[model samples]
Target chain A: MAQKTYAGVTVELTDEGYLVDKNQWNKEMAVEIAQENDITLTAKHFAVIEFLRDKVEKGETLTIRAIGKSGIVDIKGFYELFPGAPLKVATKISGLSKPVSCV
Target chain B: MTEKEEYPLKKVCIICAKGNLEDVYAACVMANGAVMEGIETKVFFTFFGLDAITKKQMNHLHTATVGNPAMRMPNGWAFPSVLGMLPGVEAGVSSIMKKQMEALDIPTIPEFLEMITAGGGELYACKLATDMFKLKKEDLSDEVKDIITVGEFYGLCGGQGTQIIFT
Candidate 1:
């Protein structure tokens, strides 16, 4: 685990950089992390991020196709916004743990 | 860290060349898994694998019970090869597998494709295979973005950390 400070709040992260205690997350931490990954938060990004957070709360499996059909953002728009790794980056910014389903 | 370990995996291209229900779903599951991990993912349907992407045939895909080493009876017994050759045995086995997957909450093939594509994963059909099978573009699921050649498949995987997995 690694420790990082955001907005004067110290938090734990996994070796892969996912948040350890999701309760420690806030919009400010999300913004900092997004900035670290070269993304600037926008209304569109928030829409997807908030949806991901909600899905986590409900214990739902998030898939690319599911997100695409969510009517939140189409698949093309998702890739355009997140670029390199949409699901990973979006979930990280949303303050979720690293996905265990993908192998 | 060594140079070899420094470069992170950036993309994954999975080539599905078999049409068997289990084989095609295995490719779909992996491709979907890659996308779930936030890796750029692409699945190429080639040869008989095209059956998975073809609209008319995708849902009708069947498990290959003949000589399948992994098949097992529900009673925790080994499924015999001789019995597997019975006329209805293949369908029975396929239905059993599908039921097991459903019990585990795994998505169906079309649903899996929907999930993968929604998550920003790319789907493609092989140009040669499509032509050889005389399949028109309309024959494939709308998720298939394009029909491309094997060289083009490798081209998409040209990035330093890109992985090409054949199934």
Candidate 2:
């Protein structure tokens, strides 16, 4: 396991930098993680993150198509919110494991 | 030994030459996958592959039930070639195939094109094939950026870490 400190809080992470313990994640760390990817999180981004966390908690699969249908954002808006591999970047900062979806 | 620097794929140029349901889906999946990975993606459709973007045909694609070596009955038995020749068998089997993919969260061909382009992937039709079939731009899905020549398509594939895939 890898470790990093964001906002004075050290947390376990995967080698790829996703949080190993979702509970260890906080809003401040989310902002720091987004910064690592050069993104500035906004209310819209947080809403998507909340949706992803809920979806994962329910033991559902993560897919771009599902997320597009999330009603929080359309496919294009989702891409714009988290550019450059939206799913990967979104999940990483959302305290979720890296998504294993192709579409 | 020192750790090697990672060199990720920077771009993908996919070419689809067939129009079968599986063929078109394969191209769509790969192109969309590349786009989701943040790689620059360009899809070129030629010959029957144009059916994937053709407005009247894109969503109505069918996989081959006859002469498909991997085909099997739902019970896991080898599909009989004779049964495949019956009317509606191909269509029935193709819909089943589509359902299977759908259950895996794969999008329909039209929706896949929308997702790909929404992520900044570019789609094009081959000029030679479009002309041979007498197809015009309006015949293709609105998601298609243009009908381009092979030379022009090749020009877009230029860049380091770019792969040209023919499926």
Candidate 3:
């Protein structure tokens, strides 16, 4: 599959889902990917991505839908579009050691 | 651990029936879950279920009386349906139910409606049921996106990869 770049994130779309180079992925990149895929980017989406990225930075593993449910995009859509990608909520990934609350 | 792959369901339709406190709470929880899961969600309220969506009556939604197996009273006591006919009985039941739900961290029907809408779920009023009950649009919650017939609702549901769920 040909690799695509969105906001410096190297992404490749596959039958399973989009694969990204974690080194090149960031919250801005995720938002850009959603936009490219025609998914509406709301404040909630960004919040989740930010949370997920923080977990990764902290060496914590997480899932995307575990993030808060306020986003406009369906959790199903998020998983389908970003398979294997961790979701964050307010700087804390679900499986991460450190817990950060956005409330 | 690796993240589990999630296959997204396209849509969900909720059918709400009027009952006691538990029934109302169940409807709200299901609807909220659908919206959270990213399915396009719609809720259809009929009969007593309509009270949960009514502007003024929503906060005062009550428990059903008589022949309902789900109802329970203190000390294994059961109330008769005849008592339900008395004025303020419904209100009393509703208030108690509300208090219980609040303790359980469940939001009220109006709050649930707001959560669903804020999460991008659609809200509709049943046309035939509304007309049958002499309910006007003004009587419904302000969040209602539209008043639609069952056929129209089905039309919206008619697409590739959509699922209709009755709660």
Q: Which candidate is the best by lDDT?
A: 2
lDDT of 1 by residue, B29-100 (tens): 889777766788999999999999999988888886668787788887888899989999888888888888
Task: Identify the superior model by DockQ, candidate 2 or candidate 3.
Answer: 2
TM-score to native of every candidate shown: 0.79, 0.98, 0.59
Model 3, span A1-103: residue lDDT tens: 5577667755664432344345555556656656544555566556555656565687654432233243535544554433322232222211123322111
Tens-digit lDDT track of model 2 for A1-103: 9788987899999999899988888899999999999999999999999999999999998999998998999999999999999999999999889898777
Summarize candidate 2's per-residue lDDT along B69-117 as a digit string, tens digits.
8999989999989999999999998988889998999899999999999
In model 1, how large is the Cα lDDT of residue B52? 95
The global Cα lDDT (0 to 1) of model 1 is 0.84
Q: Is candidate 2 or candidate 3 better by lDDT?
A: 2
Residue B105 C-alpha lDDT in model 3:
48
- Candidate 1: segments with Cα more than 4 A from true spot: A58-81, B1-5, B36-42, B102-105, B114-122, B148-159
Ranking by DockQ: 2, 1, 3
lDDT of 3 by residue, B79-144 (tens): 777777688876777687678766654667787787677666778888988998899999999888
**Most accurate candidate by DockQ:** 2
Candidates' C-alpha lDDT: 0.84, 0.93, 0.62
Candidate 3, residue B53: CA error in Å? Answer: 1.5
Q: Which ten residues in a row have the lowest lDDT in candidate 1 chain A?
A: A94-103
TM (chain A), candidate 3 = 0.45
